[model samples]
Structure formats: structure tokens, C-alpha cells
Target: MNKRLQLFSEWLQEQHISLAFITSSPNVFYLSGFYCDPHERLLALLVFPDEEPALICPQMETARARQAGWTYEIIDYGDADNPWQLLERHMRAKNIKLDRIAVEKSHLSLERYEQLQACFQARSWLNAEEKLRQLRMIKEEKEIAILRQAAELADFAVEVGVNAIAEGKTELDIIAEIEYEMKKKGVREMSFATMVLAGENTANPHGVPGLTTIRKGDFVLFDLGVIVDGYCSDITRTVIFKSATEEQKLIYDTVLRAQLAAIEACKPGVEIGSVDRAARSIIEQAGYGPYFTHRVGHGLGIELHEYPSMNAANAMPLERGMTFTIEPGIYVPSVGGVRIEDDVFITDNGAGILTKYPKELIIVS
Candidate 1:
């Protein structure tokens, strides 16, 4: 079993839980090293307090799971088989007993929970969501290495997006070019939807990339990431289409300052909220506090957004090996928004930046 699985098993033992059904794709891949997104299809990892864990997935994924180094028993079901029924048979065959069970409350649907309850006649269900978050928050050396490579690809993607920008190009066109180049370079998937917001559309933090045309003097934002070996990288950068107005330049510089300060505050043992405050204070001092609507950053890794949300109310202390994004933005309605984001990790010394793409305002004509 992987160290992550062992850690989870130990937690289960401490809590006196007899069985655990891990259903989330990210969590499953984290513990098993085999990645599978069953979508609406059933996929689960059954863990025991001391016994070897078993994976229940589609038969099609069994070969991939074995190749990923899964040595434990695998219970795979074909389309004709009811996976849950198969699960019961497999557990009975293995003499597995479940008086009470644990589950990922956040990812397990209500229907799935009902099915498990009927199948096991469990006495109780404990939430293992927070424990799994804690386990995955700390990045191992191997994870960090993969994340660095992912960050490098994210930086390259930004470069591609910027280079693809032109006066007459639509946001969708730019996104297509960026993603096409990523495929050419062997990026298996983007961590999330690639964002390319142009002109006034940039004012919306989560604006959809569309047919909005780019124009000279428009501020274009590129927020994107790529998955590398199951790890993920997230980054954001905004540049002027041709020349930036004075007000636009000021907004861009303020956001950059806040991002830099937030990145600097990512030292070990520091309260996470203070880091958010450090950036918010900067933007507030610039008289754009209300315009900056979101938190300073969020934990980044297996999934695009994970644990340790860097918001004003979170008091968790930063620990070495914790990786997350440091992104600060100011979006003024009727005016464009400026955001500077970088992937960073907590280190013994301080913050270590993984994404090295230039943060200075770039003007492309």
C-alpha cells in the first residue's frame, strides 16, 4: 500500500471505523496512483483499518490500475454486472465485515450513500473529508517535482496565449490556439477550463471565454493550468492588447504588488488569514478594496481547488510542503481587471515560487 493509503488506514483504525469508501477521483488517484474519472459511473476504493485495501472500478480500468502499481485486490465489474452487487460479493468472499463505515461526505452523492447503507446495513457513517484534505495538503518531494513540471507547462501556455493575441482575434480563438499548442506539447489535460477574457470581459473574475473580439488598449487576461503526472498547476496573467492606459497600468501594478506581498507572506508557521489580509490591505490602500472580490489564493494540487483556502477567515498556519496559488486581482466594473497569479509552495526557508513566467506588465501591439 502507498504511504497515503497507510496513513488513511491508520486514521481509520484510530477512529474505530471498520470500512471506508473513497469515491472522489482525486482522492482515489492520490491514494492509489492510478487515475480514473468514472464520471457518473461508480468508482470506489474500499479501505480497512488493518487489512489491505481493495479497489472497485470498471473492468476497463483494471489494466491501467495494475500498471500504476496497484498490487492489492481489484474488484472490477463489466457493464452487465451491477457494480454494487459485485462489491457485496467480493467483500463476502474476502470475509470483509462492516459494522460502521467512513466516507467522503463531500464527494459521495446521496444516492450512492443510500446504496452503501443498504448494501452494508452500516450502523453509522463518519466524514473523512477533512482528514483526506489534511493528508493531501502536504506535498511529497515526488509530487513537488511533478508540480514544478506542470508549472513550467502552465507558464509556457501563458506565453502561447499572449503570442496568439491580436487585434481582431476573439477570446475563443486565442483559447483554441493555446489549447492546441498544449496538445502538441503533450499536455494530457488542462487543470480547469482555460480562461481568456478580453477588454471589459476581464472585469468579471470568472468570465467565460467567448466570441468577444480583442482591441488595441484592451486588457486581456489568461488564467489557465495543465495537469502533469496527475498533479496540477494554476496561473493567471493579464497583458495589454497594444498599449495600456494610465489607469489600467495603475490597476495592474497594484495587483502585482499585492500578489508579491502575498507570496512573500507564505512562510512556514504564518497564519493563512494574515497572508490574505496582507494582499487585501494593499488593494484596499489603493482604494480598490471593493473591486477585489475574491480571496488571495487557494490550495492547489491533485485538484484545481483543494484544502487550506487562503481567505480572511481561515486561521490555519502554513506548513512546509504545502502548495497553493497566490493570486490577487482588482476588477472594476466598466473598466478592465488586472490579476497576477503564481504557483508557490511553502518551504523551510520561506515561499518557493514554482511558476517563473514574467509578472511585469507586458504590452503587445
Candidate 2:
């Protein structure tokens, strides 16, 4: 059995929980070393307090799961078969009684929860999300190695996106070029949708890439990430297609200053909120507080967004081995927007920046 799963089983025994059902893709990957998005299909890892754990997956995924280091029993179910019934049979065969069961309330759908409830009588549902979060917060050596390479690839992606910027180019065109280049380099998937917002569209924080053409003097933003060895990376960079106006330069400089300040404050024993304040204060002092919407950063590892959100109200202290992104931006409607992001890991000494793309203002033709 995997060491992480062994620890989870011990935790289950301590909580007096009969079983733990992990369904989220990241959580399942963390426990089983198997990574796959089931889409609407049923995929779950059931861990018992005393008995062995079982992976309930589609019949086609059984062999794949085993090859991915899942040595425990895997209950394979067909499309015509009811997975819940099959799960019950497996537990019954092991003489395991369902009483106090733990579930990922945040990840499990209410419809599925109802189905699970119908199958168990006199069972209590406990939240396993917090425990899972705690288990994943501290990065192991192996996980950090993967993240280091993931961040390097993210930097390479930014380079590709910036170089692809030119007059008469659409946002979609740049996105296609960047993704195509990454794919050719062996990147199988992106962490999330690749974004290439141009001109005023960059003002929108989460704007989608479209047919908006890249014009001279327009600010072009590239926000994207890729998955490497089950780990993910996120980075954002904004550049001017031609020469930047005085106003555009001010906005870009302000954002870069704020982002660097926040990353510099990333050290052990500092509260998470302080890091956000370090960036937000810079933007506010520059008279762009209202325009700087959204948090300063978010945890990044197996998933783009993980735990220890760097927000104004979160008081969690920074700890060693914690990986996250430090991103700060200033968006002014009708003017343009600028964002500078880098992946950093908390170390005993200070922040160890993984992404090393240049932060200086770059002008593209």
C-alpha cells in the first residue's frame, strides 16, 4: 500500500470512521498515484479503517490503475452495471459494516450523495476535505521535483506566447501557436483554458481568448499553465504589441512592483494575509485599489488552486515546502491591464521562485 494511503487509513481509525470515499481527481491521484478525469463517470477510492482499501472505477480503467501503482483491490463496473450495488457487494464480502463514513462533501455531488445515503442505513457522513487538505499542503521532495519542471515549462510557455505576439494577429491565433508548440514539446494537457486577452479585453481578469486582433500599442496578456507528471503550473505575463503609452507604462510598472513585493514577502512565519497586503498596498498607493480586483495569489501544485489562499482575510502562516503562485494585477477599463505572475515555493530561507521569466517590460512588434 502507498504510504499516503497508509496514513489515511490510520487517520480513519483515529476518527472511528468506517470508510473514506475520495472522488476528486486530485485527491484520488494523491492517494493512488493514478490520475484521470472521469467527466460524468463514477470513480472513487474507498479506504476502510481496518480492512484494505478498494478503487471502484470503470472496467476499462482497472488495468491502468494497477499499472499506476494501485495494488489494492479494484472493483471494475460496466456501464450497464450499478456501481453502488457493486461497491456494496465488495464491502459485504469483506464483512465491513458501513457506519460512520467519511466523504469529500466539497467534491461529492448532492445527487451522488443522495444515492450513497440510500444505500446506507444509520450512517453518519463526516467531512474529509480538511484532512485531505492538510495531507497535501506540505510538498514532499518527489512532488517538488515535479513542480520545479512544471514551472520551467510554464516559463517556456510564456516565452512562446510573447514571441508569437505581432500586428494583425488574433488572440486565438496566439493561443493556438502557444498550445501547438507546447504540445510538440510533449505537453499532453494544459492546467486550465489558455487565455490570450488583447487590448481592452485584457482589462477583464478572466476574459476568454477570441478573434480580437492584436494592434500596435495594445496590451496583450498571456495567462496559461501545463500539467507535468500530474503536477500543474500557472503563470501570467503582459506585454505591449508595439510601444507602450505613458499611461500603459505606469499601469504595467505598478503591477510588476506589487507582484515583486508580494513574492519578496513570501517567507516562513509570515501570515498569508501579509503577503496579499504587500501587493494590495502597492496597488492602492498607486491609486489603483478599486481596479485591482481579486486575491493576490493562490496555492498551486497538483491542482491550479489548492489550499492556503493568499487573500486579505486568510491568516494562515507560511510554512516550508508550501507551493503557490504570486500573481498581482491592475486592470483599468478602456485603458488596459497588466499582470505578472510566478510560481514560488516556501523554503526555510525564503521564497524559492520556480518560474524565472524576465519581469522587465517587453515590447513586441
Candidate 3:
């Protein structure tokens, strides 16, 4: 068994979990090297305490799984095959008790849950999501290296977007240039839909990019990410077009200071909520607390948004090897918005920032 599967198996053994049916693509790829997006198709990894792990995927992806380094039994199902029936047969062949079967509580749909129940009729169902999240919360050295590469590409992507900015250019125009440059760099995918909001559009958090043209004295927000070797890097930088008024400068400076404080508070042994609080305090003191809508940030990894969320209510302590984002923003309808985000990795002493795009407010003429 691979190290990740071995570790998961040991956990199952310790918890007395009979079998773990991991369904999510992220968890499956984390445990097994194989990564596939079987849209509307059944895909999973079955991990047992005393038997070899098995991968279930579409028949077309069997070779891809092998190429991705999965050396175990692959139960490839064809379109006409009933995957639930095949899974039942495979588990029964092992002659193991299915007393306490674990499933991903968050990812398993109601229909799948019913199918699982009909398959083995286990005595109890356990939530496997928490264990999987805990397992993937910390970054391995290899994963960190890939994340660094992803962050570098993200930085370059932002640079491309920043350079592509111009008066009368639409938000979609800059996004096209940014994505074109990323494609040239061999990036097959982005962590999420690229967001390039300009002028009044920036005031809306999670704004959608459209034909909104950039104009002088407008805040242009570039929120984008790049995927490298299956890992992801997210970054958000806001810059003024041509000139910045005094009010805009104040809002931008406040967000930058808040983001820096939050990043500075990221140290091992510190409470995770403290980081959010550190940032929120600055924004609140500046009277833009309500303007900051979402949580400070979220964990980042194979999935764009992964484990421990950075919010003021989460009491989890910061740990070395944990990676997340520290983004603090102020979005005012009339004044526009400013968000400075960075991908941060917690270290033994302090934090290591992965995305290195300049945070200082920029005047793009």
C-alpha cells in the first residue's frame, strides 16, 4: 500500500472502521495517485484495514489510473454495469464484516447512501470526511514544492492581468489575456473561474466578470489562481486605474494593513481564530467591518478550498505545514472595494507566503 493509503488504513484499524468508501475526487487522489473527474460517473477508493485498497473508476480511465501510479485492483465499470452491484460483489469476495462502514458525509448524495445501504447493510455508518480532512490538512514537503510552483504561476498570471489593464478595456478582455498567458505557460486548469472586476463591479464580493469597461480612477480587482501538478494557488490584488482618490487610498491601505496583520499572526501554536481576529480588528476599527462579508480566508490544497477554514469562530490552533489564505477586504458600494490576498503556509516560527504579487496599491496608467 502507498504511504497515504497505509496511514488511512491504520486509522481505520484504530477506529475499528470496517471499510472506508471515499468518493470525493480530492480524497481519492490524495490517497491514491490517480486523479480523475468522472463527471456523473461512479468513482471511489475503497480502503480496508486488513486488505488491499481498490480503486473504482470508469473503464475508460483504467489506463490513466495505472499511469498515475495506482497498482492495486481497479474495478472499472462500463456504462451498462451497475456499479453498486459490482462494489457489493467485490466486498463480499473479501469475506470481511461490514459492521461499521465509513462514507464521506459531505460528498455522498442521498441516492448513493441508499445504494450503499442496499449493498452491505452495515450495522452503522461513520463519517469519513473528518478523518480525510485531518489527513489532508497538513502539506507534505513534495506537496509544498508543487504549491510553490503553482503560486509562482499565479503571480505571473496576475502580472499578466495587471499589464493587460487599460482604460476602456473590459473586464473580460483582461481575463482573456491572463488566461491566454497561463495557457502559454502550460497550465491546464485554474483553481476557480478567473475574476476580474472593475469600477463599481469590484464593490460586489465574488463579482462576475463581464463587459464592464475599466475607466480612470477606478479600482480594478484581479482575483485568480493557477493549478500546477494538481495543486492550487489563489491570489487577489486590487489596483487603481490611473489615479486614486484619498478615500480609495484609505480603504486600500486599511485592507493591506489588515491582511498583513493576519499573515503576521500566523505562527505555530497560535489559535487559528486569532489570525482572523487580527485582521478583522483592523477592518472593524476602520469602520468597514460590515463591508467585509466573507470569512477571512480558507484552506488551500489539491482542492481550491479544502480543510480548516480561517474564521473568527474556529478555535483550531495554527500548526506547522498547514496552508491557507489570509485575505481581508473592504467593499463599499460607492467607494468600490479593495482586497489584498496571499497564499500563506504556516512554518515552525512564522508563516511562508506563497503568492508574491506586490501588495502595495498600484497606479496603472
Candidate 4:
């Protein structure tokens, strides 16, 4: 068996689970090396305790499944037919009367879950949602390489956005310019919608770009990310449209300091919550605690948001090879907001900042 499968088998043994159904796109891709088409039909990747592997997919996707580089016993069903019947038949062929079967709770809909339960009739059905999550939390060398490439592309997109910002330009125009540059630079898609907030709109962390025109002396917040090689990179930076006011400068400085402190505190063996606390403390001390509303950051990989979240509530320890972001912001109601974000890779020695964009306040006229 391959390294990933081997690790998964070990985990399954530890959990006393003999059969597992991985249906999430990322998990299926990780195990079967197959990327499923986003459709209404459900595809399942099944791993048994001792068998090789098998896949239950729609008949339409059989060709693509074969080309996914991994060999598996394929059971393809057509539309207007039930796929769970095929699943039940496969289990009988293996002579595997599963006493306990694990399923992805978060990804499985209630209707599907009910169908699965009626079909399988297992002794126990357990939620193994975190099994794949735990496996993906630690980055392999190849995953890190892809993420580095994504981060570089995101940095380039930011540069393009900075240059595109000018007086009289609409927020939507700036977003279009940044997205165009990202695609031109070879990014196939964005991890999320590009956020282009100007003036008071910056106070909203997730403000959508609109027809509002960029004006002089307004703070423009740009939060963007690019998807490259199935990996994602996220970043946020605020720039003055023309020049900064005294209040804007102070808020910007506080956010930068908090972000820097959070990045500095990231290291192996530390609790994930510590990273958020380190940044939150700085903002709170500066009397902008409430303004800094969101969590410090989140994990980045095949999915934009993954395991080992950087939040005060998370208890997961930071381990070497973990990749996440450190984003701290201050959003005042009427005044503009400032956020400085960077992607960091945890190393044995410390954290390595993957993003290269300058954190110093940028004044554009």
C-alpha cells in the first residue's frame, strides 16, 4: 500500500473501524487520486481493512476515474438507479460484514445518511469526519511546494491590485483588474471572491466589491487569493487610495503589529489557539479588541479553509509542516478598516512567511 493508504489503515485500526466511506472531494482526491466532477450524483471512495480499494461512481465519470492514476475496483451506476445498492453488493463480495462503518458526517446530507443506514444495516455507524482532516493537517513536501506556488501567485495579484487602485475607479473595476492579472499570470481560479472595499466599506471584513467609486484619502482593503495546482493562498492588505489620515495610520499600525506578533509566535509544539491569542492580545491592549472581530486565520491547502484553525477555541497543537495564515484586522464602524495577512509555514525552528508583500502602509495617489 502507498504511504497515505498505509497511514489511513493504521488510523482505522486504532479507531477499531474496519470500513470507511470517504465522500468529500478533498478526501476522495487524497485517497483515490481522483477528482470528482461537481454534480448532483454522489461518488464514494471506500477503503476496507484488508482489501485493495474500490470506488462507487456514476457511469458518466467512469472514464475520468480510470485516468486518475490509481487502480481500483470500479462500480459505476447510471442515473435513475440507486448507488447504495451497488455499495451493499460490493460489501457482500468482500465477505466483509462490517460491525462498525465510518462515514463523513459533515459532508453527508441527512437524506443520504438515512439511505446509507437503511442499506448497510451495520451494527454501528460512526462519524469519522476528523479522520481525513487529521491526515491532511500535516503537510507533505509536495503539498507545501504547491502552496508556495499559490502564495507567489497571490502576491503577484496583490501587486496588480495595488497598481489598479486610483481615484475615480470603481471598486468592481479594481477587482476585475486584479482577477485579470491573476489569470494572466496562470492562476486558473480564485480560492474566494476578490474583496475590494473602499472608504467606509472597509469596516466590513467581507464587504463585496460594488459600483462605489474610489475616492481620495480613502482606505482600500484588498483581500484576495489565487488557486494554483489545486492549492490555495489567501492574503489581505490595506492601502490608502491617495494619502492616509491620522486615525487610518494608527489603526493600520495596530493591525500590523498584531499580525507581526502572531506570526512571530507561530512555531512547532505550540497550541494553535496561542497564535490567535498572541495577536488578539496586542489588539486588545491597543483598545481595538472588539474591532478585531474574526479569528486570527485558517489553514490553507486543497481547500481554502482546512484543519488546525487559528482560533482561540481550537486546541490542536501546531506541528511542523503545518501551513496556515496569520491575518489580524481592525474594523471601525464609520472609519476604514486595516488588515495585514500572511501565509506561514510552521518549521522545526520556527514559522516561515510564504507571502512577500510588504506590510508597511502603502500610500497610493
What is the TM-score of candidate 3?
0.99
Task: Give candidate 4 regions above 4 Å deviation.
Answer: none
Give the TM-scores of the predictions, in the order they appear.
0.98, 0.98, 0.99, 0.96
lDDT of each: 0.92, 0.90, 0.93, 0.86
- Model 4 error, position 344 (Å): 0.9
Which candidate order results from sorting by TM-score in descending order?
3, 1, 2, 4
Tell me the lDDT of candidate 1: 0.92
Off by over 4 Å in 3: none
Instruction: Give Cα distance to truth, residue 39, candidate 2, Å.
Output: 2.5
| 291 Cα displacement, candidate 1 (Å) | 0.2
Residues 299-351, candidate 1: write the lDDT tens digits.
Answer: 99999998889998999999999999999999988898998999999999899
True-structure lDDT of candidate 4? 0.86
lDDT accuracy of residue 266 in candidate 4: 88
Q: What tens digits encode model 4's per-residue C-alpha lDDT throughout 39-59? A: 889888888777777888899
Give model 1 RMSD, 1 decimal. Answer: 1.1
Better of 3 and 4 by TM-score: 3
